[model samples]
Target: MKSIVILIFFLSSIIGLGQDYIFLESKNGFREIKLGTSVENYPEFNRKDNSNAELFKLSLNSKADYVYVGSNDDKIKTAKILFIYLTTNNNVISEIKVVTEKVLNVYAILNSAYGEPSSKHGDKWIWKTNNIECSIEGDQNTIPGYHIVYKDISNERIELKKMKLESTKKAQAEL
Candidate 1:
């Protein structure tokens, strides 16, 4: 009984350590984006026409990189719809989000690539590693859209977000 208890505690600690972030196991990102790649180092992919092109184009204002690849009949022409890279510590690509129309197809691909998910709720499935959290979710509407997100653990990002939240609250309080 004591041996079993020790084993259980050891396993739990390992699991806890794996869940430290949302994108820890993300080795690939939208064709060539790749996780853990520095923004300045990633190559520029060919952009194509797509329904979400405009939306991704607009998102470029805030993100380090936003590229759109066209789609036809809900199938991405380039196998990817959009590639978004968020700037974090040292201007590296800390977060990546890919949008697609084939939710199940992408989910299957991710499952095979990342193994079993840690948790799943409805349309969203989450996989965690020591430094990354990977998530896939889709909408329920007539024209459902799927999103694959990879987030890395970055202290700079957390601090920046905290500062933004504080500023927003301070402004609201003054108003």
Candidate 2:
């Protein structure tokens, strides 16, 4: 009985990690949070109050905008998942990252929506296209959890974002 209790405590504290990447090719986004769309459209990204989640804060730098999904988001509905972080450029979402457990359900959901994964690399599964890339892999950077990253990788978009950043920096330097 004591051994069983210790095992339960150990299991409860560790987050499970499994899943192939989700979303269609060229998605450049996740759900309604599409890349190249105005960040103003999603008020959830504006709430920067996740400092209370001390464990989640440890792996991130200040540039990472930790998103707080709104009430309307009924979650993924089949897993212990959280839309933990995102980044925007030119006021548009460039990346979205999530952490999830019990992700077997997510694997099925994504398999149906996105078809076979492009490739599997050890514990990670990835789907890459000309426009975007999505992957689900083990990330022990902070807490024990699987990571899902959906990012825009269009070359034109990258160049445009770079130009904008440099232009803004140049403008700041003039000050």
Clashes of each: 10, 0
Best by lDDT: 2
- 43 in model 1: Cα distance from truth in Å? 3.9
lDDT per prediction?
Answer: 0.60, 0.64
**Model 1 CA deviation exceeding 4 Å by range:** 1-32, 45-53, 57-65, 68-90, 142-144, 154-175
RMSD to native for every prediction?
Answer: 8.5, 18.2
Q: Give a tens-digit lDDT track for model 1, residues 1-175.
A: 9999999998987766453232344454545656667666654533223643455443322453444344453343434564443444565666776666564567777776667788998868988665567888765564235767777755546788899999999999999
**Cα-based RMSD of candidate 2:** 18.2
